[model samples]
Target: MNAPDRFELFLLQDGEKKITEKIFTGLSNTSDFILLKEDHTLGNLIAEHLKQAPHVLLAAYKIAHPNVPEVMIRVQTDGTITPRDALRQTCQTLVQMYFALGREFQKEFALRQFADQGDQGGAGNAGGQGGPY
Candidate 1:
């Protein structure tokens, strides 16, 4: 079958706003969140993180179709917390993880750069003579 014709729904243009809203479910402690202009990258990440939350009973996400750029994430939580709280906690955890990853990456990058500089014989090499170790 052919894809949907709504290109604007999938594409983000200048001055366009990103949308995220909660869809209340008939059952308590369960809700669906809609995230527009997102794809599997975010959906999978969120699902994985949500699954890690102790209070979350279920966490899943799907796209209606590949043509659609929106993700519908359904979360069911225990009575201890709401789905919104689980999602909020997931976001915070993800942000902290991201920062930690960046910090580790910077440290590794600096180490690699220092190693490379050392290999290049780092300054004070006159007349291309090898220095004594």
Candidate 2:
């Protein structure tokens, strides 16, 4: 039997974020299934991040391999946002998180330095009393 032609469907697009559905007609019937199996975890991560958007109604990704591997992504919104917007927001949130962590590290490092200086000063003032005779 001849394989069908591969095609992609766009379920939604509003000049911004878009959802794409890809159909891999004959790939799923192959003996190697590792890539397809790994895609499930990747798709779940994407769906979870996309759902963090405030205007997102629903976001999901699935791979069907009954005969061939087909990937589908459906992202619904409240008409006030797009998938692109949600993605941008997610990136911004991640950046903010990283920045906060860096600041905390800097604060901790400064505190450690201050404590070490105080210890050194106190030891110097002890006038060789390092060991209790």
TM-score on alpha carbons, each prediction? 0.74, 0.40
Which regions in candidate 1 have their CA more than 4 angstroms from the true location? 1-27, 120-133
Off by over 4 Å in 2: 1-49, 60-74, 116-133
Please, what are the lDDT tens digits per residue for candidate 2 over residues 1-133? 6764443132222342333333334333111112232345545665677677677776676676644343455556565765456555765876676687777767766766677677875543323222111
In the range 1-133, model 1's lDDT, one tens digit per residue, is 6765566766776875564557566767898888888899999999988999989999999988997788889989987988888898999988888887777777766776767677786653333322221
Indicate the TM-score of model 1: 0.74
lDDT, candidate 2, at 122: 53
Q: Which lDDT values do the candidates have, in the order given?
A: 0.80, 0.51
User: Could you tell me the TM-score of candidate 2?
Assistant: 0.40
Question: Which candidate achieves the best TM-score against the true structure?
Answer: 1
Which structure among the candidates has the greatest lDDT?
1
